[model samples]
Target: MPIEIHQSDPQSYAVAADFLNVADVEVVSLQHEFGIFGGNAGDHILELVQRLRTPLVTTLHTVLAAPDEAQRRVMNALIRSSARLVVMAEKGRQILQTVYEVPNEQIAVIPHGVPDRPFLDPAMAKHDLGLADRTLLMTFGLLGPGKGIETAIHALPALVRNHPKLIYMVVGATHPNLVRHEGERYRDSLVALAADLGVSDHVLFVDEYLSIEDLLKYLTACDIYVSPYPNAAQITSGTLAYAVALGKAVVSTPFWHAQELLSDGCGMLFSFGEADALSTAVAQLIEDDSLRSAMRTRAYARGREMVWPSVAEQYLDVFSKVRFERRSAGAMVIPFPASVGEHDRLPPVSTTHLASLTDGVGLVQHTKFAVPDRRHGYCLDDNARALLVMSELAGLVPLTPQEDQMTLT
Candidate 1:
């Protein structure tokens, strides 16, 4: 169903809620970004989620380190309402725990998913694009001021002096939001900057939103991928993820996502808006074949874990767990006489499920109903706590044979 919620109209949220209630969806997966919604700090979403009849699993695209009062209020309400939360990076998980006081169990750190593409020689890809003679350096995504394309343009003059065949390709159209307000001013400024620097011949702008197939082709053709985004707080970048998964040698600024994904020699990082530094890093990668090849290999190896099939499985696991919990919570309710106190009506806890989760290594991190899911693997943090609990239980009471087996495992 394609029910639309008007961004600025508060009542549209109520209508959306009503539509979803009748849509027969067992679960709702919301892709959340603060700016995409309306009202003060996106409070409009709270109304929709509050009225939702289906279980909500929110994937947070941006997690601010420090939010203002209104943002904090809205975030807290959303967290309280959601059945589960998903963030792309560990830094976002840290912010949710320390800054928002969200519990660790509520947040799932699934990486930004990317297509699984085999590594290809850039020269062959460049031949298909009819640019085999030139060395391509590319940056893609919606064009906007925050993307810092002018910095890349400024660096081109220095780069072109040594590698005369180098061409800087700025792919994608101007961002719709930027076009709505500022019209093409940011993109024009970049073009004029390149012209002023006398490197206009070296810059190519593919001004359209590309389909996935075309985007992959462009990414494969590029010798180096550049991300000059000035913002350090950005929590996710699908383009950056795609580049890494395709085994491109990436040169990026130290944003939150880039810093984490590019660590351990996967890619090179330069300071934000530093033309000389960006130029130097790109030049080094271009000059050293062994270093560039090694970086690509490491990046491709790490990306195997982030490919679409693996990411999809992780998402399905989260959905299954949340749906089961919702159903279990609904089934636990029973009508009692008014004289019955809340404490007296509580149900006894069972260790059956706990035992099922434990294995030879440790407790599996997640489950689908009673079945343990090994896809998530075991965490040392969880194992340490399990050990502590077993130790405490042994001191207080005699361990059952089954419990002894668990401790041994």
Candidate 2:
């Protein structure tokens, strides 16, 4: 399906409703991080959703457990605007329902998606990465404070002593956003801490943005993937999800997303900032090969449900429900006003114009009366309208492939 990209400025809410006027656009998929901390971007998103005539599906990137009055109001407005809400964890769903008063039916729990990759043996990967005979432990992704990397580094000193052959690889560069404002302060601090702990040689910092191919190579080589993020409210971690999906044993802090993904023997989790617990979790997994292998198998099996294809299908299901509801609503005839004339009610809101406006791809957004305008592009709104009209009239009109895609969304 061909996708139309409409760019909207994040800081401005003035033109939030303009996109709603675009033709043939059936549904809007919004990614939201509800906050004013970063230039009131979330407010802009909420404004857009409020003005949208098409159905909206919002994937909330952050779900605050203890939100303030303003935050709560914004989240409530967002939930109301959205036809369906996608959260990456069940914990996030609970937070929305309990804290924000969102209906249980309004939320869909979809796991963070990961790419499908063939499982590679860690020993083979270690050899390929030139770390022969060494026990590899790793944590990766853009670096910044609150990542709890220092806690992971602090734990390393004791870990290296128990297993002399162990090497901890701190992968990826400083987070680009953090670098723009804070320079290298966080990375320098982690490096300094590793030096102070006398584990500098054991801790390898690979400071560069890794390509997906290279990242998977490094992930495949690790005996255990550690995500020592300290934030308890964190609802999603793509890095952690990727490691789990690739069949690697994981040791992570008990953040909300981790609590969900790591449950049921899929991975090990420790309390936030607990280096002793973190090290113990890693050491236990490292010592027991059978247990580690079991974790990898379980994680990989669970990950299959969250792969991109699976996630896409789940999204389609939500979109279909929204489409059906809209169609049923449109099919109902509104009561005529007391001032209505006989001529106005003669046509009975027929779908004739909608049928005339459609072509092979879908219904065009703009037209000169009943004639289709080719210059204007196909849109989700018009396509959705066409679908509703067609559905109400049964098989009198059939939806094109593009129209079908729009209605499904």
lDDT of each: 0.91, 0.82
Q: How close to the true structure is residue 81 of candidate 2, measured as C-alpha lDDT?
A: 83
- Candidate 2 lDDT, 1-409, residue by residue in tens: 3333333454344354564547576777777775432334345456566777888888888888887777777788888888888999999889988888888988998888888888778988899989989999899988888788888998987799899889899999998878999899888888888889998888999999999999989998998999999878888989989999999999999888898898999999888899999889999998998999999999999889889999899988888887766664549757786765775443434545565666667778888877777888888876776677656645445556644554444
Model 1: lowest-lDDT 10 consecutive positions: 343-352
1-409, model 1: which lDDT tens digit per residue?
A: 4888889988998889888889978898998889999999998998799999899999999898999999998899889888899999999999999999999999999999999999888998899999999999999998887888888998999999999999999999999999999999988888888889999999999999999999999999999999999879989999899999999899999999999999999999999999999999999999999999999999999899899999999999999999888884547756675665676543543456668999878789888888988999998888788778877777766788888887777
Off by over 4 Å in 2: 1-17, 35-38, 332-409
Full-model lDDT, candidate 1: 0.91
Among these predictions, the greatest lDDT belongs to 1
TM-score for all models, in order of appearance: 0.79, 0.76
